[model samples]
Target: MEISEIQHLAALARIRLTDEEAGAFAAECDSILAYVAQVKEISTGGSAAPSAGAHKNVLREDVETTEPEAYAEALLAAAPDRDGRYLRVKKILGETP
Candidate 1:
């Protein structure tokens, strides 16, 4: 990696690097690229398969239940403050009607 390349990368990443930092990064980048090049030189026999039992989706079926009254009752019961049949939460958005 060259200093110019490092500067270009820093600019693309929107980062500001000192001259010393850029030189250090250039050396580090060179080392990383060398390692990647070495990894590419490795040869695999082109056989890829699952070693253990096959994977299966463990998710439960989606079943929409209509129980608004029960859900509203549970929600109201959990509220710290409430009016006769509605929750009385603190005013969060500007002035209320």
Candidate 2:
């Protein structure tokens, strides 16, 4: 990816990357892309299935009515700021509420 391409992507993503940062990130992205291209060049000599013998997701029924800790953590993580169980996001309305 070129520096200009990086800038265009940053604009589309609503992110602000400095000129130097954009150039550096573009080089890094290009390196990663090249690595993926190399992987694509490799031949899949023998493959019965795409993900053969891969671990199957043996899902079980919802046996218990309990929430996972990660679920609460994820919600709190999304808050701009948080205290206890409260999501301290920016106020959306005026005192009229």
Candidate 3:
């Protein structure tokens, strides 16, 4: 991404950075993207890209029974208000389609 694009992204994220910090991050992004582009220019000979470490799908048995009520209780404890089973949340309009 361009430096301006990076700055725009930071703004969207509500991150406040000094001009020098934004420029530094932009340069870092440019270097990383240049490296990626250089790699992409090479032909992989129809082979998959190298994996840093080979990892295969891990299979595990389902261990679910019933979640303890204490689990829900802990989460609800952080809630401003909760009705029996669910937490009550404030409604904010205009984002949903």
Candidate 4:
């Protein structure tokens, strides 16, 4: 990267950088960009298959162990206020009964 390009990027990011800082960033960016290019070349040159003995699925199969409403009675028993089977919370908006 050139110093002018680095200065433009700093301006776009709303960052204030001195001439010395911009020069330093330009050199750093050049090295980083070269490393990325090398990585891209190596990745593109290889086969897309995984090596043997590697675990294909690291996660267990998803399974439901209980009925969906199994906890309803326990939750209703713990409520501070309830209207029959439903919880009764405070009315925070609009007109209240």
Candidate 5:
């Protein structure tokens, strides 16, 4: 990477850099790009890559293990405020009439 390119990038990112900093960043960017090129070469030239179907989503069957509303009484009892079997919470989004 050139120092000019680094300076342009810094300008785009709303950053101010000295000439010394730009030169340092240019060297660092060149090193990173070289490393990425090497990785791309290795990935493309080698057969060590996994096959298309090598990965699959492993999920268990979604099924209920307990009866519905089994803990309703316990949950309502723990509520700070309740209307019979239902919990009463403060209205948060709308204006009051």
Candidate 6:
């Protein structure tokens, strides 16, 4: 990576870097890219480490249950806001309400 390339990348990432930092990062990025290129040259179409076996799925069967009314009421009482039986939480997306 050149200093200009590093400066461009820093700008795109919204990071502020001094001239010294940009120079240092340019060298580091160049070294990393060279190492990656070397690794790519040596890699074959097989895993470097041995695999134990094929992957297994261990999910349990889903079950449905209903809580008692008193239990549900206790939970609602601990919330910051609520509307009847539903919890009223702030919207995470779109414009604020």
Best-matching candidate per TM-score: 2
Prediction 4 global C-alpha lDDT = 0.87
RMSD of each: 11.4, 6.2, 5.0, 12.7, 11.8, 8.1
lDDT value, residue 79 of candidate 4? 95
Candidate 4 C-alpha error for residue 68, in Å: 31
Off by over 4 Å in 1: 44-97
Of the pair 2 and 6, which is ahead by TM-score? 2
Question: Local error of candidate 1 at 64, Å?
Answer: 15
Q: In candidate 6, list every pair of residues with a backbone clash.
A: none
Model 1 lDDT per residue over 1-97, tens place: 8898899999999999998999999999898898889866777557954465687658866775775575877877888999978789787889767
* Per-residue C-alpha lDDT of model 2 across residues 1-97, encoded as one tens digit per residue: 8889999999999999999999999999998888889866777786635774778888889786566674888878888888888977678887875
lDDT of 3 by residue, 75-95 (tens): 888888998878887776757
**Clashes per candidate (backbone, < 3 Å):** 0, 0, 0, 0, 0, 0
Candidate 4 — which pairs collide? none
Per-residue error for 6 in candidate 2, Å, reads 2.3
Q: Which wins on lDDT, candidate 1 or candidate 5? A: 5
Candidate 2 regions with alpha-carbon error over 4 angstroms? 8-15, 45-49, 63-80, 91-97
Q: What is the lDDT of candidate 5?
A: 0.86
Q: Model 5, which residues run further than 4 Å from truth?
A: 42-97
Residue 84 C-alpha lDDT in model 6: 87
Clashing pairs in 1: none
Give lDDT: candidate 2, residue 90: 71
Residue 54, candidate 4: how far off, in angstroms? 19
- Estimated TM-score per prediction? 0.42, 0.51, 0.47, 0.41, 0.41, 0.41
1-97, model 4: which lDDT tens digit per residue?
A: 8888999999999999998999999999999898878856665545676566755757766887789879888999999999879999998798857
Worst ten in a row by lDDT for model 1: 48-57
Question: Could you tell me how far off, in angstroms, the CA of residue 37 lies in candidate 4 after the best superposition?
Answer: 1.8
